[model samples]
Target chain A: MSTDRLRDVLRNSTEHVDMVELTDAALKQSRQITVRRATVGATLAVVLLAGGVFGAANFWPKTPGDGVNVADSGSPSASAPVEPGPSTAEGGGEVTVPPRIDGAFLYVTENNGLISWKPGSSPKTLIADHKGGEDMIFETANVSPDGRSVAYNTTSGKLRLRDLATGKARDLMDVYEGNFCGTPAWTPDGRILITPNTEGKSGLFNPVTNKYTELSFTVNGCQPRVVKQGGVLMVYFIDGSVSHLRGIELESGKVVVDVPNTAGSRRATDMSAAMVTADGKVRFTMRTTTLNGTLGDGLRGFGGDSLFELRDGKLVDLDFDDRTMGAAYQGGDGLMVLRQKIDGKYEVSIWDMHQGGGFDTEDEPASLKDALPLGYTY
Target chain B: MPDIAAEFTEFARTHTPSLLRAAFLITGDQHLAEDLVQTALARTHRAWRRIEEGNAPAYTRKIMYHQQISWWRRRKVNEQLSETIADTPSRGDSAEDVALQLTVRKALLQLSKTQRAVVILRFFEDRDVAETAEILGCAQGTVKTHTFRALGHLRKALPELADAMKGNV
Candidate 1:
């Protein structure tokens, strides 16, 4: 038939399809997929770091006063490690990290609950009832420095912690009245949880006494991570448009490091920012608009922002390979997770700054095999 | 930033019917057509911020086309063919019109996935050969070849429409 006739036929054929119902279902699916992607991003970061230090002796040097002890060089005995079986929960499975990676436990938040897995042990669900929904808070939950407790907020705005040893969950406090609380950051001492409220304010909740302390500072967008040097680095929209990274001292509530004030750029986008603190340093990704009042071509499309590190009080370009997409998160003991987009697939790797190493710099690329092919569990 | 949910709701309300039509032509099943539109819209929702405002419908269309091909490729073996056409008569459509529509859909099921996609994008969607090639991530020549082959198959399957096909070709 004529093309117009065919178009008319096709268009009229869908008269019975309910657009409203389809859109509603699509919206729910979209939100779930976004959450799943965020969880996958965090899980991949941890797995990349775990794979990086797996098995070689003297890979990580323990530093004094560092809170998160990811590895003790002499801890894993000379005995052969046990191989863990498959995961028992639905949509959960065991990912085999290389046998050489000793004492590395990867904690992933899947649809069923928070799961913890070692190199060879079967994946075990730490909390069984953790159902992910629209109200589920936290992009990436914090595993305490001692690795004893996992802290996250539920969809109902209640901050809860699950004891890894007992699989028992304890309600810490009601964080807010809604579903979208930003991820909480744990202090170096693991004594307090810094939770971000949807409305520009942050609260420090002491799990010991179940008390909440409100911070005087306000963040316009995105959550903040606590730096090792007793400062909180947050990305906030200054004047509602320009994104700025300001470091505030936890005790005095004073802005210690305002990169935008020193660097002289006011074009950052609020939502297009991510920050990670490792080795007493901060690395962040920010999207900036050009002088022509349009987003730069580099930051216009998907995954198109460059990572910058605050070094010597200046924002220095990490200058990773053009293929490197962005930085994800910083692991304990100076490991930074970076994602490299090669041929449209994201490959996660760990960058070590303490080894005089930087992305696409003097550091050798970590050799990691593709593990955890569970494929977007949520 | 605009409220993403509200913006998406408005966009979907305006475009969902058209998208469902395109998806119906692609999938050749009513239930599967609704699913295809929902999946495409869901993907578009995730990238709504990155996609320019006027490009939402085009973005969703692209996702629908790619997702249909991917699904066909993954489940080609298990796809059950409907032996009979299940056509719901539209208002003002006579028995002959409904029969012709069912015939066209049946002929569509006979074409290869790529050939069917090229036909839908080029003819029904009115995308030029270059635009079809760009959407399908193929060379313009490939789109031309697919369109030619697909039309030839349609003409043979529905001889009654051969005159119209000849006029369009």
Candidate 2:
């Protein structure tokens, strides 16, 4: 319509608004917000100050390359994904796999309970048999952002941190039975975000000092992402039949934006992986999960996941077709989506969010298929 | 001074209708419009003392527009336009007006969320370019660009209403 007619129609439409109902709801929610603020204040009182003493210190000693583990394994095939098998090296019959490609680097869980990877030269064994456990014992072994540490969960329900340089694995905390801390997402500054219970008592656990800061709000969903640029902790939860994607501000612990998936809309019903793009926006995948499905595989869900970009507080469909089980990583200047074919082959799709060029897919290692970023946990 | 609770309630009730009109235009859905207004009001209540004396309506409008632009949330279904408006048609309204309203709503959804916000603030709310830019937290140049693009989109989407508009915008 003409600009004037558009204005007239909208102004006249307000006659239909129920002011009393709207005001009441707003007032009630405002009261709840006040309560939440109070809760955050109370929780802050008990935050362990011991971790702050370290003050963002590197977990490993600084070496050349600014402590970044660029030690590349001498495996002839550099692009091959690591597979489970017996070690080929002739030293006391150790079983090991090629280092998994994490962005431009790599990491691997040794059968001897060591989380270590050397990037450029022959692999460096941090310690000789520091602990005894099969490779399968360590679930969700994720390399840290600085490539100096690995955060993993044991099958015995312990959240453990392994220093790749020292080969020391320390227990950070004990998780509840039947749940593994395998879904830990690392912040940009390298603190592990773990929801150790079903009640959504999530918080950031610093591996350097093993201190935890409980979040003010509970997150019922797994795979919570802390987008530093957006300053919001993005989460996905289901409220009845409607799935909700919310951004909780990290500093204030306030939910700044909430998008709900309503029936008949193309919005995400269930979200999968989320990663901050080069332009500082979070991109995630959404799929519908059936009751019969398992939470393993990071809730890959039925019919695969479709890509969506969070823009201007709305979920803009990225028009990506799916079966995308895992995708996230800041590998290059573009955003990456790792998709797996039904035949078990994996490929990477890179899309430039600001630029409108469609994504380019190239065959990639299955190791790049992770729910979190390349160096983050499953 | 009046009771803070009562004062806030009165403020909410007084401003909600006008807020919903702008919200409805931006969201293009009756339910989402209510949600946008309510959320903004709730935030305004938190800062009530600070803003109550210093233009609470503008503060709340800024929150509504900013939240709509920068926040991330899951999608909720859009309720049918006919269902909400049928019961409360203003006097002298005809079927043609209703049809036009629905058509305009549909056409508005075609634009990006930011584009729609620019159109609503500039046209529906009669906000000047600077005011619209301040509310949306964007540069004035962005508002002008979006306004130009949005008007072109609307004209194309609603050709029957395309008769030359007398409005300067």
Error of 1 at B59 (Å): 1.3
Clashes per model (N, Cα, C within 3 A): 7, 17
- Candidate 1 docking band: incorrect
CA deviation > 4 Å runs, candidate 1: A1-12, A15-20, A38-378, B71-78, B87-92, B167-169
Q: Please, what are the lDDT tens digits per residue for candidate 2 over residues B104-156? A: 76677667667878888887788999988877666799888888787788789
lDDT of 1 at A11: 56
Candidate 1's residue-wise lDDT over A173-289, tens digit each? 676645343556655434556776545377676554455677776543334455444233332222232434566766556776765511223233322223444446655444444
* lDDT accuracy of residue A269 in candidate 1: 39
User: Which whole-number lDDT from 0 to 100 does residue A93 have in model 1?
Assistant: 34
Per model, kept true contacts as a fraction are 0.40, 0.43
Provide a comma-separated list of chain B TM-scores, one per candidate.
0.88, 0.82
Q: Among all windows of ten consecutive residues in candidate 1 chain A, which has the lowest summed lDDT?
A: A369-378
Write down the DockQ of candidate 1.
0.16
lDDT of 2 by residue, A225-308 (tens): 544444344444333233566667544567765765422235454554556655776666566433344323332122235566
